[model samples]
Target: MKTALALLVGSVMLAGAADAQEKTIRVSYETPPAHIKSRTIEFFKEELEKTSDGYFKVELYPSAQLLGPSEEVAATARGQIEMSAPYFSYIAPVEPLMNIYQAPLVFDSYEQLWKFLETDEAKALAARLESRNLMPTGYWFENPTRLWGKEPLRTLADVQGKKIRTVPSEILQKAVEAMGAQPTAIPGTELYLALQQGVADGAFTAPNYGLTMKYYEVTEAVTKLDLFLGGYLVLFNKRWYDALPEDRQQQLMDAVAASRAFNEENVQKDLAKVDDDLRAVGQQVIELTPEALAEFRDALAPLYGTLDPQIQAMIEQVRGL
Candidate 1:
């Protein structure tokens, strides 16, 4: 009888081991196939597998293969996917304070943005992720925001009367309206068709995105407005992370930080390539003169008041830094 009991116990133990070994995690993104966002996800996959000795694996789904940007946060929270890299603005509806980073002209350089993100204000914002059952591992940089139009946009006056596609953010819509252009909020996927069909005239985006999305094919001019730093968040499902062993959690965090540094370095290099590619394609590239840039900045000043109080405070902290 004792021998029979031992056999049954051993069988249950083997089944438990098999269940643990079957664990799999999925990471998804909406960026185009060739974009840096895809590259970042690739890095995450490689590093996590290497560090965990193949015990932890990340399967990547790019170009909204699993869910669109609007649905990613909720899907992750519900454990439908293990992770997602979402644009800051798309997550703004869940955490309104996130729009602080989306504020026009708030960050003039990558260094400025990095410094602010390391502060208490940024930590406070990151803590909000816990309430939503998400963990913000780190951020990957998108190129500085700029304009793409069929015709050259040398100054704010040039954008007047043009119907521009923008994200459905109140601040961005207000900024576009204040600059004298009619704002049309559209999803990222629909942008190309909208521009080609004359449903919209032009839109604002990072140079790298333009290259990846083939915006240069439809738009002949690239304007360097550098109005806002496009930011993306790397998030993980809190439940999955919490279930991991302590050492495994540490390994994952270290890998993510290392990957983020690599991603930022690559972005700087790609920015130079984007400039060369735009010039090669016969797209007119225009840099705003100091006087004109200031004028454009002044026109969007009202956006500061439109931000949430927490976001306003975060901006003040960033400025003070």
Candidate 2:
């Protein structure tokens, strides 16, 4: 009996030591816990821990607790953080090819966006990110974003000179400006106050953001522009990822892939639910007439001509897809 007791204690000690040896990956993103991306990251954490048998653990810092939107890319590249899930456009400053996600009036459907992600142009963009010490795990596509504003945005003429909040992407800025709206680059955290105080007239974002941020209370109408596909790239520090054991690396990728699929499968439903929530609160949801949408599309066409040759080629590749 004493020998059996001694053996049991030894096994318990061994298990404790193994648990202590587990490696941890710290992930940061700029969305709230309620956001679809954040919810998907939660699934990744669960699947990773389960699939790895607790050999790896994930520490998540959502709502920019560990790093703000603008800081995530640089922080991850420098290995200050192990991972980040930021809007693909935010990474464009470092790898200009990533700006393709922000090009207006492209990607009519979620499936179309996924198809482009598998194309050669997408592969080239991934290579560019790797060159910057960032390795992409996967991409989580959000529902096509809509334009929410204080006033209805039905036709190109309605947007003229309206100061609309947008991300810090040259491509997007140019696209909005070409549509006759003055693009204002403001941080997401500041969007509510910006709109309420008249600092900006509106924004282009997903319905999830509208429901999460309660933008419906401030904005009068949301035109289902469905102008662009917005999404997040789950990126890891290349140096850190390269150092991981082969099995651990595969586990990470598998987790990301599973989470990406889960998010994609649920995003359409979530978008619909968010729209329902917005309407329940009395916000007007506008669906532009085909002619009105065409007018806006035509006004923004020159943006394609203004892109760099490489970027323009990539855009064409995606458009063709």
Candidate 3:
């Protein structure tokens, strides 16, 4: 009888072990799987599952399968979703300080951007995000936004009188106006048609956007303005994260670090390919000289003063980096 009891006890323990390895975590984002944002999450999923020894499963819902871009952060915060990668601009309205990313010429390279993100200033910003019930773990540098148009935007004067499609933000709109261009907020779905039909003269966005959405089909020139390094933030529900065991938490952070590195490397490589692909298709790729970029930067200087003081300080810190 004692031997029979031991066998039953061992069977129950084995079942519990099997159940423990079946944990599931769901992640969502608005971008297509081909985009870096979604690809980064894929890396995160891989690292997490490997690090946890198959104990964690990450289900990626790309292309807004679970939630739209604007709805991601709120949904994560409410614990309706385990994780989400949402555009930084979408969070700017709720947290005005986050607008530092939109300040033109603030971050010229991915290295500079990452250096600033590792600083205390970024920690405070992360804390602010945590206050909203979401924990920001990593940042995905989506792409370097540039000015592309029917004609090359070679000089500060080139932007004058041209209507450009931009993400509708007060700061961005003001920046566009300051550069002597009108900022038109057009949906991504309509951007290609807008440019093709002459509704807008050009658009300011990532180069991949032109490639993916086939904006290159209509636009003839692209200037590497290196205006702003747009990013998507990886967020987890704070309450959920806090509920994890200490070991589990450490494993998650480690996985996040690995995933971030993977993303940074891949994004850099992809950008180079995108440039080549754009050029291969007969698009005029304009590599801006230092002098020309300086002229454009100087013309947009007034925008620095328009930002909130804290945001301005953050920009200064990044510039110093």
Candidate 4:
């Protein structure tokens, strides 16, 4: 009986040691503290720890502390980090089809963008991540894209001969050039300095981003263009994810879904407050007339034809939904 008791105690001690050896995952994102993206990640970290009963822990590195926007996807893929939240445009170089999410005027509302993510085509795109040894656990919506400039951009002609900073997406670059602007690929972190120094005269970004990034301080005008909706992929290192127990895997997936919902709610709230915030900061907000809106959309139409066929098919499938 003493031998049996000793054996049982040894077993328990070994199990405890194994459990203690499970490492905490590190997740990275480029969003600053005031951004909803950072808030959503905080929510995930809290909920995941509670749900896992301390068996799983998440270490969040925000504001490019661990990896910059352009490097997040590659870092996650290489397992340098366990996970990252990267804007689709940043990952398009690895997954060119991701550029579809940046296609101007494709999604009229956040609801439509979420619906497309659950579609078959989106799932197929998610599958492509396996090749890079990465997994897209889910996606979060950023606010609708808006134009910020020193001068009013009421029509395509207004943008002619101007330098515009855009995320590194071929579609956006082509669209800006088509509108007669010199398109410059600039990282988000450097945009404010670029604008203030006259390296670029304008930028395309969400209202909340413009406000949080202090774009209003550099530019005098914010145009309500609503040209595109920004989407971010919450990716995980496949090897790390696959090694987790089945129950832990399910918990992570549930956490992702919950975090995404939280992010969506926050974005809606922030966007509602953007105009007032921009106005308070002395930025003029302009609404385009219907004719000007049509002209802006027409200028980007050629992009629809030039996008990858796979992306075009995905767009069609999403529209059908």
Most accurate candidate by TM-score: 1
User: Which residue pairs show collisions in model 3?
Assistant: none
Q: Of the candidates numbered 1 and 4, which has the greater lDDT value? A: 4
Q: Please, what is the TM-score per model?
A: 0.93, 0.91, 0.86, 0.92
Candidate 4 lDDT, tens digit per residue, 125-230?
A: 8889888989888988778889999877777788889999898888899989888899999988889899999999899988888788888888989888887898
> Ranking under lDDT, best-scoring first?
4, 2, 1, 3
Per-residue lDDT of 163 in model 2 = 94
- Highest lDDT model number: 4
Candidate-wise lDDT, in order: 0.83, 0.84, 0.81, 0.86
**Two-way lDDT contest, 2 vs 4, winner:** 4
Better of 1 and 3 by lDDT: 1
Better of 3 and 4 by TM-score: 4
lDDT of 1: 0.83
Give the Å error, residue 6, model 2: 27
Model 4 TM-score, 2 decimals = 0.92
lDDT of 3 by residue, 1-321 (tens): 999999999999997875553366788776677777777888889889998998788998986778766677788888888887776777787678888887878887888888888898887887798889988887777778888899887887888899988875667778888888989977565678999999999998888767767788899999888778888777888888887778988888888888888888888888878778889887888888889888887878998997899998898788788
